[model samples]
Target: MSEFLRSRRARLRPRDVGLPEYGGRRRVPGLRREELAQLAGVSVAYYIRLEQGRGRNVSSAVLDAIATALRLTSAERDHLMHLARPVSRRLRPVARPQRVRPALQQLIDTMENVPAYVIGRRLDIIGWNRLARALLGDFAALPPEHRNLAWQVFLDPSARALYEDWDAKAADVVGYLRRDAGRNPHDPDMASLIGELSLGSPEFRRLWAAHDVQDKGFGGKVLHHPLAGRLVLAYETLTLPADPDQQVITYHAEPGSPSAAALRLLASGQEKTTERTLSCSEA
Candidate 1:
């Protein structure tokens, strides 16, 4: 909790929050503890206690005030709540590999035109459909460790060229990972993944240390496929009720759009899947 607060505080500058800045070679990144206390309307000592994780049962009103001072987004605000009031038992489930159900496989197979794949807790691609292979590349082709979404974002050479707004996409992935880390602090695999990424990618290290949080959900992406050209797909992320750690991400192009045409072309000559799984609509 303290680390999250400290990192969040470090990312802010006094001038960003309308506080006057005294130019100097300051060691800390953002507003000082005293400056933040003034902005949040709390005693410096109390705010310090909060930052140090010494406060018990912190009031929602106080947290709200601090959140306002920090200018947190809805996702960041949720992460703050998680860090501030985490349950011991649910902090991290035992590290087990996530799997896709038969019904889920059917669903992916049914959505012939949609590029969809199931991701596990640490963003590992557990399952992918034909269109997903066409769109996201063959996750099965990558080594087990490199099969992770976040890992690929930093390690994969072609990923940067695939996304028009690569930095923004990478930042969002980091934010999602940060949120997951807060929620599942003790997951060993997640911890190892973070350590590896921090050591391997300087950009990942910088973003991870910043303590940004984001809820991964419905979104749109513009991807440039080598064979299919540019595609504008509206994406939706759906969670499986039975397994909360698993998420099915599916992308669809608008009807009659160029993206739709591209999908049609990509699906052409692809094997006709006779079986289908339960889809997002059924869920």
Candidate 2:
């Protein structure tokens, strides 16, 4: 909570909230404790306590006032509340395998023309359809640890080659992991994953320290696939109602686009290969 609050406070500037800039340069990024105290109608010492992890029994009014002073969005404010009022949650290993629902599997199977997959809390790829396997690499062939999205994005050669903008997407994946870490501070699995990633990739550490948070939504992506060459696609990520921790991300190329033509060719190749394998097994 302290770290998150400090990060949030550090992002705001004095001039942002109508504070007159003094001629002398100020040390803090945002309002200092004293300035925030004045804005939030609280004692400077009391606000210091909260920021420094010394405050207990913090009142809702103070929180509301601080939120107003910070101009936090609804989601950020809710995240702040969760950080302040966290409950003990069950711990799960970051590499723990997740099961996909039969219905979801069936749904993805039916959408043979589209690439689709399921991802779990740790951003681990839990399940994928055949088209997804072609587009995103064969997740089933990877070790469980290597199946995680962030891990693959950072560590796998194929992943780096597949993305047109590897660095941006890699940062986004790290940001998601950072947000999850904030929410589950006590989880040993998360701690272990962070430690490993920090040791392995300096880029991951740099991104993790940035403390960015992004909610899942629709987006467009371009990938340079070995089989399909340059392909552009739009994707929508939908969180499962039954299991909020799980999400289904589906990708589609616009009709009559070059990407769509590439996808069709890829699908045809995969189908022919499948038929050949089946015939060999029967023979």
Candidate 3:
């Protein structure tokens, strides 16, 4: 984890990150120890000790300040918190997939107004409703190995075109997955996913080395649609209490907003299209 921290810190630039460049030739890529310490409100010695792995037990408050100074996303902040502490000795093995309980499936089906889907800790899309399918499209239709959020974001060309703010979105995906990797470092699936993406996508490779992590949570997203042009939506992620590693993400648009109107229009058309396809199959 110290290696991860050092690697991420080295990738950031002083001027680009709002730190003043000291007038001198430097051997490092990002802000100097003193600069980072100043930005994070810590002493240069303390920051150096932490980076060098001499200071292992860091407080959450200090970590939060450091994460803020780094301009880390929510997911990245969470990962930093996890890494500041030593790994747990009693960590459990990864759980196997099972049918999403009938009740949960029903709950998803009942969310008529919002688009929602359940994803496992490994970022696998385990279950989702028709609206989710319509919004995200056939990416979920791919094989399980290819259905991961990170894979879709980096490997799929369509994802780059779909997101209005593609770079930000890509960072979020990488950060979230990094957090997941830190939490379950022993999980072979997590390792394999990371390896595949690292090998396949240059963008993924670059971001992965940054060691940024984030807490999965609610946020705003801007999407460029093939049919609707552009839409902005608020997203919320809720962890299932019963299912330890499963989370439901829902998308909503403000009432009377063009995005909301467009969602309604899309929903109606999607329902009609489903009916027509079913009818054609029956005939």
Query: Whose lDDT is greatest here?
Result: 1
lDDT of each: 0.85, 0.81, 0.80
Q: Looking at candidate 1, what is the lDDT of residue 249? A: 92
Better of 1 and 2 by lDDT: 1
Q: Higher lDDT: candidate 2 or 3?
A: 2
Please tell me which predicted candidate would have the highest TM-score against the true structure. Answer: 2
| Ranking of all predicted structures according to TM-score, beginning with the best and ending with the worst | 2, 1, 3
lDDT of 3 by residue, 64-175 (tens): 8888777776665667776777466576644667356778879988886688888887788888887888888774569877777888888888998889899998888887
Predict model 1's lDDT versus the native: 0.85
In terms of lDDT, the poorest run of 10 residues in model 1 is 272-281
User: Rank by lDDT, descending?
Assistant: 1, 2, 3
TM-score of 1: 0.83
Give candidates' CA RMSD values in order: 5.6, 2.7, 4.1
User: Per-residue CA lDDT of candidate 1, range 168-240, in tens?
Assistant: 8899899888887777766778999998888888999988877778886998889998989999989999988
* lDDT (Cα, tens digit) per residue for candidate 2, span 1-283: 6777777788887789888766578766776777778888999989998988888777788888888888876656766666676655544345434799898899998888899999886677898998999889988888887778888887777777899998878877876776566566676767877888888888888887766665646888899998799999999998899887789999999999999999989888878888999999999
